[model samples]
Target: MAIPKVFITRRLPEKCIKPLQQVAEVKMWSEEYKPVPREVLLQEVQTSHGLLTMLSDRVDETLLAQAPQLKCVANLAVGYDNIDLEACRLHHVIPCNTPDVLTETTADLVFALLMASGRRLIEANDYLKQGKWQEWGPFLMAGADIHHKTIGIVGMGRIGTAVARRAQGFAMNVIYHNRRRNVEAESELGARFCGFESLLETADFVVNLIPYTETTKGLFNQNAFTKMKKTALFINAGRGATVDEDALYQALLEGEIAGAGLDVFSQEPIPKEHPLLTLEQVVALPHIGSASVETRKQMISLCCKNLMRTLAGEKPITPIETSR
Candidate 1:
């Protein structure tokens, strides 16, 4: 019998790929930064039994139809929004995502972004680097205070709950809104479940950790921003499409909200000419929420394990429920 073949969309650290190599013939795109071209991915999947994909790769009906032998798709990130799970289901291919492993790591970033935006750390750094600090003034670079403030978290999932735990350390009050209430977070973390509009109205820091779905797309719009405290700081570590970028820009421009720290955008590799980047009040990061070395390696390993197990006719460790 021919050995099962697996294709990895991007070049990963050799150590993480080694275990999979032992189980199947492994092929990887040579470039680390560049995504595999669509043509290349389609061509390679024609002969592949499994695939390890990045969020940048689109695993839709188009790709699925070409991949006749594909048994599994192990997405490298926790969110499987990039993959067409329904398509995978119809094709009888299991879809897996790296979850739980990066929850805390991503939570750490959410808190950091919250702090950076509240304190204007990025702006201050730029001011000093630009040689604008001629004298120390009491009001110079004054920013929002995080301690003892109310933090409203949208989406009380693994990462959201992890962020609530961190909020406890700083003595901040936590309030959350989810599709359904998370009673554990309410009892253990002292989080209060509130209506979405009320959370927007009250939180000193509105931290968006909601995922992207048709329902959540553009959930944070102009009205949502207007509902927030004029002094509020917004932090988005969630899927970018959850916010209307144009509306967010207008909000900051008109002082509907104070500032924002963003780790993701509606578009990946957000163009340099994007209007949001022009705002000094906005601190933008390149979707590095789970970028810590230790956590990233763990995510990669989990993806490898999922792919290996599925190709071997075993259940995946974290299969996504496509029906939802």
Candidate 2:
């Protein structure tokens, strides 16, 4: 019998690959920064038994139809929006994601981004570097205070709950809006569940951690921004498509919101000349919410293990539950 094969979309740490290699013949895209070309991935999937994919890889109906031997798809990140869950279900492929492992790390990044934008840390660094710090003044680089302020978190999932815990430490009042109320979050973290529009109008720091879905796509448009306090500092560490980039730009331009800290964008490696980048008040990061070395290694290990398990006729470690 031929050995089962697993194709990894990107090059990962060799230590994480060794266990999978022992179970299956493993092939990986040589480059870490560049995604595997679509044509190459489609070709590799033809005979592969399992796949370790990145968020950039598209595992749709078309690709699934071509992958006859594919049993499981383990996404490197917690969010599997890049992979079509319905397609995977129809194809009888087990889909897995690296969740819980990176929750705290991502939450840490979300808070850091909030602080950076609220306190204008990046702007302050630029001010000193540009030789504009000739004299210290009361209002020079003055930014928002985070302590004892209202922090309205959208999407009260694991990451959002973790963020609320951090907010508690900072003496911030936490309010949240979710598709359904998170009672545990409310009782344990002292979070107040409020209506979406009310949360928008209330929070001093409006943080978005909602996942991307058809219902949530472009959830933050011009009208949503218009509802926020003009003094509000908007932070999004969630999926980028959740916000209308054009509307966000206009909101900042017109002072509908004070500033923004974005980790994810509508486009990854957002174009240099993107209007959002032009704003001094905006601090944009390249989707590094779970980019810490320790957390990333855990994610890779989980992916490798999930792929290995499914290939060996065992259940995945973190299988995505599907209703369909």
Candidate 3:
């Protein structure tokens, strides 16, 4: 009898991957930064009983149909938008993802990005390094303040709520807009529920923490930015498709909004000449929202556990349920 096989999309740490090796034959793509090619991924899954994927990999109908023996898919990230949950359900392939583990770490990064952009830290640092600081001057490289300001969170899910909790330490007034009201966020976190439009108009910092879906794609258009305060800072730590980049660039260029701090972009490895990169008011990062070394290992461990559990005929730790 042929031993069961497992395909890992990227090279993971050996210590975290050791657990999965004991359960099945493990085959991992060698490159650290590069994703497995579509043809290669599809070929590997044909003989795989379990597949460990990254957000960069798309596990759609075509891939799943070819993966006749694939019993489970474990995604290393919190969001599984890359995988068609409905397709996985139809194929009877259980899907799982690592969630909650990176919540606090991601929230920390978002707030750091917010402060870095708001205070012009990166811009001022670059200016000083370029020998532009000739003399001490008042209000030099001045930017917006965060204390006692209204922070409107677009999504009040686990990560969003974590961000709101941190905002409490900064004395920020938290307002949030979600599909449904989160009573815990309202009472415990001191967050007020508000409409989407109302939050944009009132907030000093407007944060997009929502997921990407049909309703959320391009949600932040020119009209939405126009509703925001001229002094408000826009921050997106959510999925990239949630905001319209053209609208964001126009907003920053025309001073419709104060500035922006972006982690995820519409394109992965966003082109260096991207319009958003041209703005001094925009602080951009290479999608490092949950890049902490410790948290990443935990995430890998979670995925490994999820895959191993399914292979062992046990329920996954954080299974994603779908019925489509």
Residue-by-residue lDDT tens digits, candidate 2, 144-210: 9999999999999999999999999989999999999999999999999999999999999999999
List candidate 1 stretches off by more than 4 Å. none
Off by over 4 Å in 2: none
TM-score of 3: 0.99
Question: How much is 46 displaced in model 3, in angstroms?
Answer: 0.6
Judge candidate 1 against the unseen true structure and give its global Cα lDDT, from 0 to 1. 0.95
> Tens digits of per-residue lDDT for model 3 on 1-324?
666799999998888899889878999999899999999998999999999999999999999999999999999898888999999989999999999999999999999998998899999999999999999888999998898889999999999999999999999999999999999999899899999999999999999998899999999999999999999999999989999999999999999999999999889989999999999999999999999999999999999899988988899999997874
Off-target runs (Cα >4 Å) in candidate 3 are none
Clash-forming residue pairs, model 2: none
